[model samples]
Target: MSRRILLVTTLLLAGCTSGTPTPTPTPPPVKSGFKLVAFDSCEQLTKDLKAAAKKSVGPWGFSGGMMRTFGAVPDGARSAASAGGTADKAAPAFSGTNVHEVGVDEPDIVKTDGKRIVTITGGSLRVIDAASHKATGQLPLDAWGDADLLLSGDRALVLTHQGGGDVLYDRKMPMRPAGAELILVDLTGAPRVISRYRGEGRLVDARQTGDTARVVLTSQPRITFPDRPAARDDDEDRIKANQRVIDRTSVDAWLPSWTVTTGDTTEQGKVACNDVRRPVTYSGRSMLTVLTFPLSAPKLDSGRPVSIVADGDTVYGTPTSLYVASDQRWRLDFFPGRDNRTVPQETDVFRFDVTGSEPPVYRAAGKVPGFLINQYALSEWDGHLRVATTDSAQQSSAVRVLKPDGETLTQVGEVDGLGKNERIYSVRFIGPRAYVVTFRQTDPLYSLDLSNPAAPRVTGELKITGFSAHLQPVGPDRLVGVGQEATEEGRRQGTQVSLFDVSDPAAPRRLAQHHVKNGYSEAEYDPHAILWWPDTKLFAVPVNEGLLALTVTDNGLTEAGQIAPRASAMQVRRNLVIGGELWTLYENGLQISRLSTLEPVTYLRL
Candidate 1:
């Protein structure tokens, strides 16, 4: 295979709400399984908060109080015909941002509508016209670090964190305080910030359906601890002091605060108590707030905010439902005994109904035995939600099907003991069939039959030498897997792309395999780094520092070519197929290439 190195100095790229009075609390759904219950009043919420905090408080704060955040998935293209591209027109067929579901767009570093390409790089939002093939306009943002954005018609919502990316800490250094900043920009002409929002925590993720965007933020309680304790103070003494501080903290201090600025006016408020809900069992340590914003509105206002007293690590959204799952890391008891036993390894999932343009309504809650790997671990289909989990204690993985009854998600069917002694690496649900990959020493790909929700059983299993970290469906009967090629001893070598034929659920087989020694691709773990053009049957992934493009065939994967921009210092973060041109986004600029020939064209430096 031939390789193209497009050298260019200039081309490279880079990449809510306020409180309001809520309506009367809806009665909890009537289900025999677990559920989330809203607090009746501020007084009741305060009482519940204090009691939970006081019991859970310890020397460092709430016991087992660390929060986990997952990486966002990559861009997705709907179809070759969409985005206003036709062979008869001056522009060729084009592709939009790669997303998980149709009509549900995720925030990404780059986006396009066939005519123009918009991206964020070096704290600035840049736009390039496809016709002119040149930089058109730019807007400098007040961003702290790296950023991503969601596009809706002539509007763009750019998300940034205060600390300029994830912070690292050590015994000698202090943890940097972080917050999330969302800037709403108008894309009618030159991009300009029309409104700005600052929230108390980092952004979990955001998803858009049509003109509405829903953002998820996770925040810890805003309580200060003593910098230095007395010399005589011990662990127990410090624990007591932290508990006392929790006792004096008011309900407002535990909720997430927000400030939204529009022109000369600004609104500031914390999440309302009435809008907060909690599971029957909670540690009350973290607040998970979901804010809904109308992106096409004249000006961005404080969004409709609804919050829950739980931690959100993974967020998944479909057209009609949004699911948030947490690993539930809190301790079982507020006070620790000598044993210091913690809560069981489990994940709590909350479902919200997002049918209309209104704010999402809390619909149901459920618990699974093990924790989820990422957003792909949860799939909703045919009025049933399927969850894949791996329990460390049991040394096995399982797929459980749950149905929402009134206010709870009750398990209807379960298949456990899968890949015993291994952990789940990837999972994908395609209609009635499900594929699960688990790996320790070797990879076991399990095909499940979910045609009957109440009796989901594993139909077939394929043991391979490596594991796939991310699985992408090619069509109705094929899947493309991106992961590591490992040894018999479970040692990973490099990046491997495998073609899986699932035409027969009872017996699936690997059609072809391509291995890159010492190669690593972000697409292995972050699906957002992958670009699949179905019309051409081309799969492009960021391997090492360049974009590796592959041609998928029935017999095998043909290496189309590797395209790396001239800016070798910066990594290729994303790639887009816009009107016969392959637009590659680097950390600093953009590179345009001829999609058919994989040849370099003009490049733009932002």
Candidate 2:
């Protein structure tokens, strides 16, 4: 809701070993520690992906439809696999505020300073003053792809992925390059452009502690072999063509371009070669970048940029540390082509120290069992990091606590015999306690105690017909869960909000359960999409049909009212409470309603 405090922990860099440059061989080895590895040239990456693709994929029995899913994979390999930037609203006046997370601060599509509401889901940044209840001047967006806004004091940072976008900050620029732009806007009076930093990558996510913000970006190179044949009759021909073309390329061809536009001057160069670290597997090309900036700084480039040679899919951050996790299974070759049948069954955890530094420094890397469900699957506490994963082959979910040991993560505590024949539905970490929800025929909420890092164990388990996809703490021992209500056979019925009391870890009980028929909410997936105004004790979630509102208290949850959905799109993307009013954001405009009466205040069509 406002400024967040960063807490420093002694165990953050406890077992972290000094980073040393190690000369690595081809097909980089997977070690317990992280090392810097370069591709030598673009040719190496081109050749490797083709060979991996040919081996994983078999004959030409597939179409070109599946190739669009992989973010940075080589072209022509069909089938299998895919996959926010952070997203928040305002806080209520009563009990604390409605921030994105309990301790973590993530960027969102909309944020309010009690007096004004700022939203960015389209080509421009719209600033609405809560006091006036009117639309103010907007910052014109000029780039393509997705963009998000972050605010602190008199400054606002606009992150844009320059690929394909409809609205933009600069209209005269015809071609939106395949890069990114970090435009700094001064919010002292009317929004005015201050500084712009042009970069190469997609904005993964960002978090702010007070005025300091850490932004993560993933950059992939676009490589091509001019001499390579477009069509090959056999697999061998394809492989040789790839290798031949790759041999002629260099490393610079695969590196991302970087530039900073300050006033009338611009500086350009490639990301430093030695500042990157690579994973063991010859997975495709992608660089994980962490850039840090101060919100009150005069320019956007008044920060530092660091990168790792890894493909990060999920990220979790604390005030002093940031952890990035990647599932290297997608790079494995198990067929005649890069087929999507069998994915890797392991995850790689990399930790970076962000305490008292402009940018985070890579500290260590370790391997963990199975894959994570999302960012919530990782947590750092009590001088150790705990990860939640599910082994698809075994159909079991488990929690593992790892301690930093020099360059590796040594397992100090673990509990694996919990949920079987099912996957993890939700995971929430509250201090030394962990609540893991797994569902198959039913949802089992297992409580785990991690007070002793050497021996974390499950304290209790409660089963219900439906399941929770997201978990939130209503109080110290109470949790508010949002997910789908299901049948005994595991068929999803609709959205269900359940309250649980875990005062006694060994005997947790369901306090209240309310089911919304045929209703699905975005809070089930993106937790930032939830809006709980403490003043009225009303919780609002975006559903497929409309905005479902409910009154949540210690007693139970009761139906309040529903905000009318958009006429054409018929969907509510985000909802937030500011200045004692409810704001529902859609693709076209914003609907403001009185928090008490739930009556329409005004509509600002964009």
Candidate 2 local accuracy as lDDT? 0.64
The prediction achieving the highest lDDT against the true structure is 1
Q: Locate the minimum summed-lDDT window of 10 residues in model 1.
A: 1-10
Model 1 gets an lDDT of 0.76
Q: What lDDT tens digits, residue by residue, belong to model 2 across residues 371-422?
A: 7776677878878888888876666767887878776776766777456667
- lDDT scores of the candidates, listed in order: 0.76, 0.64
What is the C-alpha lDDT profile of model 1 across 482-514, one tens digit per residue? 999999877899999999999888888999998
Candidate with the greatest TM-score versus the true structure: 1
For every candidate in turn, the CA RMSD to the true structure comes to 9.2, 10.8
Q: Model 2 residue 14 lDDT? A: 14
